[model samples]
Target: MKRKTHSVLRSRSGASITFALLLFLVCAVVGALVLTAGSAAAGRVSNLAQSDQRYYNVTSAAGLLADELSGKKVTIVRTREITTKTVTEYKVNLAGGAAVNANKIAETSSARYTTKLNERPEVPTELADYPTDTNDGAVFTDLTFLDTIAVKLLLDDANFNTDEAMNQSMKNGPEQKGVLRVLHAGSTDADPNVGVADPSSLSVDCLYVVQPDGTIILTLTNSTDKSGETYSLRIKLSPSINETESETTETLSSNRDSYTDSGFHETVTTRTTLTKTAEISWTVSGVEKVVSAADASAQPVETGTPIETDSP
Candidate 1:
């Protein structure tokens, strides 16, 4: 009886050991599965974070490009040779103007970013169909009058004949009245007829000149220079020139009796504010930088012409 009881106890101990071993194997398998799932989720999150960062970096780069372009001044000479960079290279040049030898007046700025990283994912395109922004009155007017005024002054002061007047007009106006007259009076044609006024000019009726679209072209003779580029800026007069002109006419007549010719013409001089767009450009190494906007639209004025206006 004692031997049988001992045999039963040993058998029960062996069964308990087997059950414990099976439970440990199950736990190990579950732990491995949990670790694998956690690793996969972490990897996915990391990949998403990297993609977002790349997108922001690329967009910021584009903004930097536009800002630099707006702030720099560049003269387009000839189209330069193509260059290769680690990321991307910009070849700058001008169209719609006379092709001159490449002159490096000055660089607007250094490269915004320099990296041997991958090419920019977003390819940039040119911004098209923008007018030259300047303060010159010629922008609002047909500009023929601006050219002709110089010619007329040269003829009157310099005594230049028809042939000389035409040539002087085509070239920029001379700096001084004496020079114009001397050049004109010495010409072979002594008796020359004055040419007709250009009909293309818009009337400067009041403080502002109205363009075809009925938008007033407020001339800004002066503009702030940034990055060595002069921007042509035009703005609309406040209070609308049409309304202000009427008010001025009323104020002028208020002190006088009806139909009485006042001693002085009542003119309203309205103050105006000007907004400017800066012109900027740069080159990729030897690749020439071109200013297409400036070249096509900028009409050159004679550097030394004395502006004249006789007071009424």
Candidate 2:
């Protein structure tokens, strides 16, 4: 009976040991799976952050280009039709953990430029006054003043040439005497032609004039006709102020009320002066923008956040 009891006890001990080993093995496998899942989640987050950074860079580049093309100043206006190119590059760093493991990145986008040469002059209301004689010495009146206008226009076909036509059209002014003269800023005295002379070449025109009151006016314009092409237009103006001049003189006269004539025919004299000046006035207008050939197919789908930094 004792020997049989010992055998049963030993068999039971062996089963307990086996069960413990099995539990340990299962626990180890579960732990390993949990660690692997956590690593994969971290990797995915890193990838997303990198993607967002790249988007920020691209958008920043686009904004900078827009500012350069559009400003408050009148540029010389490009002489050639613009063709843009995209140059993109990327750089990465691993020091910032999986969240922001990227560093400095740069991209350059450029476009060819052209000028527009067909712009309308702005008109302004002005006051004019002139001195003539003693009675009704001066006259005051209002005048409608015309400002200078110039622009650049892009043509539909690159091969087309319209230089001569443009000059002719711009020179078609009234033949009557006292007609306003339109002098091309830098044209020769023989032919003061204005407007784009060649359709193939981009045209840039600038206009300048002063009103009777000495007020200056300037205008600029831009245009294009390329399909899928984008153009930006900007304008600026500066006017001059008028100045006045004056003079003074001395004179001597006898006192008639005091009866000073008894002492003798005292020397009598008189003094007088005339004043003249101009009044200037001006008005400006004709600011416009247009685009052609937008690519609908090229539009990209939004995959994530459209903005760069959420706050700053």
Specify the highest-lDDT model's number: 2
Q: What are the lDDT figures for the candidates, one per model?
A: 0.26, 0.29
Q: Write the per-residue lDDT of candidate 2 for residues 156-246, one digit (tens) a residue.
A: 1221122221122211222211222222243334653664333322332223332232222222222222322223221211222232324
Number of clashes recorded per candidate: 12, 15
- lDDT tens string, model 1, 1-312? 888988876765567768888999988999999999999999989766544433332233323332433323221111111111111122223453443342222211111111010121211111121122111111112323222232232233232222232223212333321101001122244454653222112111111232222222222211112222221222221111111111111111112112222122222222121111111122211111112435312222222323221110
Candidate 2, superposed: residue stretches over 4 Å from native: 1-14, 71-153, 156-312
Task: Name the runs in model 1 displaced over 4 angstroms.
Answer: 1-16, 70-73, 76-312
Candidate 2 has its poorest 10 consecutive residues by lDDT at: 125-134
How far residue 68's Cα lies from its native spot in candidate 1, in Å, is: 2.7
